[model samples]
Target: MKNQQDHIHIFSGEIADYWIEDGILFSQSKPIKRTVPLIQENIELVKKITQNQAMPLLIYLCKSPVPDKETRQFSREQLSQVYKAMAMVSAPGLSQLIMKMVFQFQKPPIPIKSFSREESALQWLQQFK
Candidate 1:
């Protein structure tokens, strides 16, 4: 898959494409419904890439349809299982709002933060590496 980042592509799911660089696992989601199976694919691929070790995640939030409640819960519960922390990269306004809106009712299972720039996200994620 084509990416703005200069990292080797690792996996491409229905919802997200993944790659790894400098101990951070990066994902850029497509504008599609993120399903449970797709999220499972995401976890399995990340586990393989990290060799079962917990690595920090960096995801670029996009205009994907909000996942169903069950899928959202599953994604939340599996966060600590696959990643030590997560950094979400989004533009300064609505995407960030949508991201938070999706998970606002519950605290994240791991460290989660949002940034407007990939550089900032990577810089913040370095602490977890």
Candidate 2:
């Protein structure tokens, strides 16, 4: 038995009801920096739906670059606030500013993790109860 709302969205492009062994896989085509808002909103939604349960979230951070620093920083700070078990797989050559953004959130009071590999990231999220 499953509730329609128990689904977990891996990112803007994918969602799954409950947890799958592989978790929900997100596409590399999604806009990384811009998805920060959607991520924030979903975090609240998940928190509400799972008021009696807590599940970790795994995010695939494709190779998409942020294009600029402002967006990177804004997205980073926003993510930090909604902290959950999250990992980002990124492309090479991302601006130093964005890299620092990821670094800033290396450890937050909220659950969070970062990875360059999608599979590894998902595994980390699955470890959460």
> What tens-digit string does per-residue lDDT give for candidate 1 at 11-129?
87677777787788888778988788988987887788778999998888777677888888888888899888888887777456765766779877788888888788888999999
Count clashing residue pairs in model 2. Answer: 0
Error of 2 at 124 (Å): 2.6
Worst 10 residues of 2 by lDDT: 10-19
- Which has the greatest lDDT? 1
Question: Scored by CA lDDT, what does every candidate get?
Answer: 0.80, 0.46
Give the distance in Å from residue 10's predicted Cα in candidate 2 to where it truly belongs.
8.5
Model 1, residue 27: C-alpha shift (Å): 1.0
The 10-residue segment with the lowest total lDDT in model 1: 1-10
Per-residue lDDT of model 2, residues 6-96, tens digit only: 4644223222122333333232334444444554555564555445244455543444444455544554565534334555555443423
In model 1, which residue pairs have backbone atoms overlapping below 3 Å? none
TM-score of 2: 0.44
